[model samples]
Target: MVSIDEVARAAGVSTATVSRALSGRGQVSAGTRSRVLDTAAALGYVVSAPASSLASGRARNIGVLLPVVDRWYFSTVLAGIASGLQSAGYDITLYALTEDPTERAVVFETFLRRRRVDGVIAIAMSLDTAEADRLAALGMPVVALGAEHRQLPSLAVDDIAVAKLATAHLTDLGHRELAHIGILHDVDDGTEREHIPSLRRRGFEQALDAAGIPRTSARHEHGDFTIEGGHAAAMRLLTGDAPPTAIFAASDEMAFGALIAARDLGLSVPGELSVVGVDGHELSGFFGLTTVDQFPHDQGLRAAREVLAALDEPAPPTTPETGPAGLDPLPFDLVVRTSTRPPRRES
Candidate 1:
């Protein structure tokens, strides 16, 4: 295997300089850094984790713990994190804990505690106090994405406020009877069933109450966070005796399903019922669903950056504080389209 020394010799720089250049740390001149990188690339030189750790006291990799790899939001966030970490000269190790208790235990108790990564970035998983304690015991910096952790630094949007914003948009259109389609996930994944749905539901209720509309239990239905689930739930809701004039889905996928349900029921969208969704999914524009754009990709990028920042510190805090991590809330914009309008009177 091509060693760092060989690359350093080929680039006419010292081994220390090669390390600095390849790691993008310390004081390496741009010209020398470029030369070292070019030589290493040409020689197929891969950095030795053991050697690098000996020198820098860090593994130069970050662990990204996610609930599922197949989901769109998770994958998009992972892409952003990977991009940001790569730019910062760090490697990412992905761990998917798909609701298996044993696997989750192994990951938290063994793999994470093994010092394989300098820090961790948990996406969309709400760590319980025990899990948070385990991570804290590892003495590495940890940052959470899409969920708040008062005991550790976290980056997330205020879900409740976003829900209120979405619901308010429909109410402003003079929608008196509105319905909400929410996702029901396992509590372990820390979304939908964990906190997002409840917070969003509360926000929806608050918005309706503020508008002097009665918040009835009949207006809500829970389903998985998939388009099919939304479709099924919405079909049932719309077919009921009292159909709502507007539907506020917690996610774009669900909103798409609501649209499908509306079509299947022979209802004219925005004429018979208006629909709104959250998450700004890429396909929202194609369907023309009015939505609250919560930049998930940007959220991932910010979470990765926070991990890098903690890694860069001279001495990371051993005891994680239960306080705001000073991360800015990602901006949200309401994208209006043909899917939403004021209620039309029946002829």
Candidate 2:
């Protein structure tokens, strides 16, 4: 491998001058910096990360905390973070926190304190007061995605708005009796309940209430936010004596399941059962499912930008919010498709 010293020699500059030019850290004349850069590019010279870190007192690596990596939303958001951070010249290290409290304690208390990363970006993981305190004590920049922390900066899609938009789409199609497939709010895993699901469920209810729909006509069923879970929940709703004219699922995956359930029961979509969902999943277009698009990938991009900004500005800028930064709300839109329409009158 070509060394920086070789590039410095080729550029007729000192090693220190080459280092300053390459790292963009110290004072180097514009002409010398440009010449050194050109020589380094020609020589394929690369700086060692450890050496750079030692010199700058920055690891130049970001730790990303995730609850799980298997889901579509999580994976897409991660992809965005990886791409953004890579372009910004930073390495990424993933820290998956399980539901096990013991393991979480080890990660937050031990691993994170090792000075391995300059900052952190947490995705959809609930942090307790103690955990938040520990992160704050790290004195590293922290950004959150898809969840909230009173002490950290965050970027997330408004789940309630997503649900309300989905519900409103069906209602606008002239569907009176509506059913919702969402995650059960009361589920306990020895931590705080997920705020997204509860807010979505409330949004669904609020839309119905605003429409002046009777409480008895507003049907609801809990799902695991998976296709299978949605299928099961949808089966129950579709098989009822007085089935709803339309259904609003909390996620596109669940909406797909509801569509499958409707098909199995020989119900013609838009004629008997109109289905709508949140998240503009890739499969939504194939299935022609109407939905509210909450760009998860974009959320990741914004979250990465926020963390990078915090890292650059180390001192927390004075914001009107209580946290180091405020919540950035992503935009959502109702995408109309073939799966939703006015309910057909019984012949």
Clashing residue pairs in candidate 2 are none
* lDDT over C-alpha atoms for residue 296 of model 1: 82
For model 1, the superposed segments whose C-alpha errors exceed 4 Å read 41-44, 183-194, 314-326
Would you estimate the TM-scores of all the predictions? Answer: 0.90, 0.93
* The candidate that achieves the highest TM-score relative to the unseen native structure: 2
Candidate 1 per-residue C-alpha lDDT over 1-347 given as tens digits, one digit per residue, 9 for 90 to 100: 99888998899989989999987779988888889988999999998878888888888899999988988889889888988999877899989875677888999999998898999998878677777667666778888788776666667788889999999999899989899899543355432234777777778889998888987633888867789989998998899978998999988899999999999999999999999999989899999999999888888888888888777772335344534344677678889989999998777
How accurate locally, in lDDT, is each candidate? Answer: 0.84, 0.85
Residue 66, model 2, lDDT = 95
Which digits, one per residue and each the tens of the lDDT, describe model 2 over residues 1-347?
99878997899999999888888888999999999988988888888999889888888899999989988878998998988898878899999999788999999989999999999999988787678667777878888788776766667777877888888877777789899998765555433335788889889888888777775678999988889999999999999878889999988999999999999999999788899988888889999999898887887788888778887777554332455656658788898999999998777
Model 2: per-residue Cα lDDT at residue 258 = 97
The per-candidate count of clashes, in order, stands at 0, 0
